[model samples]
Target: MGLIRKTLGTALAVAAGGAGYLTATTNLTTPLSADDELWSSRSFKRFNRHRNPSIQDVCWKSIPLSDVRPELRENEEALTMEFCRGAWAGYAYAPQRAIMSITNKGPKTENQLFDEQQLASSKYELGTRFSDHFEVVERTRNSVTLRGGGSPLEPGPREVDGLFVISAKLNRQAGTVDVGLKTVFFNSAEPTGKKPAPFFVELLHRYYARAMVDDGARRLTRKTP
Candidate 1:
């Protein structure tokens, strides 16, 4: 299995650097209009943007959790969700801050897409799996970013086809400053997976769904912001 592991590792160029490793994940936005397609019958066949989550908040805490790691391996008896950071072995060659166009091609789904081997190539395991039922359609771009927090701050938002930025907005309630974001993914990828790639895709789907919710919550919640 080491042969396959190393082969997969090299195929993805994960050994090229120290920060290239990272698990694959995904996200979204937009308020649906009454006549909007997201709420139309074509899309409603499977998805209901109507029931789509409300921002529930305007300004918030930490950035969304949509970028968390993707994996299922855990040390507990419970099959709970986890995004362990240390588990990411190498990430220098991994895909981060990626941007891609995904359209659901599934007979029963929409907005599903994948990019080449990102599902399992490199670091930042981010650490856990995305959502299940999520599938690939097309990749517009794939890029990554490494963030360094406050205090002299280290390197940050190193590269991108697209990137995230802090967004400011008016707070009617607080009459003070409010913050959020504008995250856009780069479009540089191919939808292909090898050997265990299918498994990776499945895991990606599951992880994405949860991450979207968590991320939105983090970004929209007044408590966290």
Candidate 2:
């Protein structure tokens, strides 16, 4: 009986150790702060955005925000043009996987379009057929906020409503920019009263978020000449 108990205890210890390692490596916890501005809006439903029936993924990076801020401020047209001109080629999930197009209904003159007020209302298409629409909702000398959402490229019976906010802060003195990207996906197919998405799906989202942040950081570093 003593030997049997020892064997069982060793097995339990190994299982616990493995579980701890998996948790550490996966980083499955949500990283959002309660004070983020995104949570302040009345339209921003916390339950719909972060809890059951929705999946939120966040990605962040600290790089040379100055390098990217210029393009972001240059105007919606210029930003879209740069993205299409291959500035973001290396950061895409797959080779030539994503494409963007802009529709500037605000102004015809380039100078006027660059004005922050005019740029806020511009619309963009992330894929061939309006996979996402983007707008510059807020901006300042040191920060910019873009809000966007649309259907997923993947087809399924489930209807998806996604809202994303990409907030960037530049610290020129430190030569670093901190970018926080938050995406919340709401699925209509989920039965009423159902729980959040399965663990594996959330895990994949976390990995994808990390990949996006890493890729953006790499691209920014490469452009910091």
Candidate 3:
């Protein structure tokens, strides 16, 4: 829990329910890059940025945390987000409950900035991210795929709620990241794994999926502020 701090605590603390609808009653300037699926939802204000790599720093508000538990909130509250300076992840558009993301927000450098290793990948946001660098796999409702690098950080089997989760150890070799997900027991035994990404980044993607929608212009605001 070394990464645990106030900001990160708050990010993970915010959970989500079913797909919440944002009203589109009024005409607004939609981003040209807005994806069709995202444009159709109320949760996402913009669609194209949901998966951008250059976007590192982010700030959002009025997120969907209505159904989250106080225990979860408290658990997340203790973490500081400072540790995430390296690489961070977030949702650019309002993705369906089914789709999520993991971003990169590490120190700015040529290799860090230029590497968009995830472009060719599809499905299983977490696995496809860094699978090329570590032993990572994904189990989606449709398929179970593997995307791993030659190097594997062995994590003994661990269960969270009767499901296997990505337990890649962080703080290993510097600049090295590992992450996984609770990929078992979906509609199918096999989930989708595109690749692997940094460990802390996995946290960012998972939590950001349920994080706040930064674009208020997309949401239906009350007459009063």
Candidate 4:
């Protein structure tokens, strides 16, 4: 009986330790900057009434801007298209659940410009689960602003909208390019009061920030040798 009691106590301690480790690892504790904002449950409640709700957040990444700029200029259309398509598939975020296929509407022009009208009229498929879409509202030499959304095809009113602005600048003194990705999520329903950020939403933001950094780094690396 003494031996059995000791074994059970040991097992319980091990289980508690494992639980603690998992909680620590999954907790959203990423540091924030003056420019960054996280969407908390409270923010959601405040914006619940409007047709579009906004959750503003900012994330930054460093890359070889000099090397990337030339490539972007040379193949802006192709690169932008690839970025948008990959975004729906979860890119580096959720590889196993990435979108299976994507389609670009209208003529294949030298510059692929999908403004608000174009985006509103077109539809995309994400593994038969969701219909994804985006609109390129503005584009320039070093920046692009757009809005994206996804909706389930099944009989439900579930949908999500997002606004994203990506900009790249060369820090000549630092010898690096600073890329900033500002994102705003629109909620369909309003929130009731101030609440902490949802775990899933926080996770999504982190994944997206990391993915953007990775994508920029990959592009710069490819141009190196």
Maximum-lDDT candidate: 4
Error of 3 at 104 (Å): 12
Alpha-carbon shift of residue 43 in model 2 (angstroms): 5.9
Q: Write the per-residue lDDT of candidate 3 for residues 91-201, one digit (tens) a residue.
A: 332232113223323332112211222321222333433322222243332222332212123322211101222222222234221221212111111222321234475
**lDDT for 75 (candidate 4):** 48
Candidate 2, residue 141: the lDDT equals 40
Lowest-scoring 10 consecutive residues by lDDT in candidate 3?
77-86
Clashes of each: 55, 0, 36, 7
Kindly indicate the candidate among 1 and 2 with the higher lDDT: 2
Model 4 weakest lDDT span, ten residues long: 120-129
Q: Regarding TM-score, does 2 or 4 come out ahead?
A: 2
Q: What is residue 205's positional error in candidate 2, in angstroms?
A: 1.1
The total of clashing pairs for model 4 equals 7
The lDDT per prediction is 0.25, 0.44, 0.25, 0.45
Candidates' TM-scores?
Answer: 0.19, 0.48, 0.19, 0.47
Instruction: Give stretches of model 3 more than 4 Å off.
Output: 1-152, 157-207, 212-225
lDDT of 2 by residue, 103-196 (tens): 3222332222222222223332332222233334444343333333432333322344445554445555786665545666665444455534
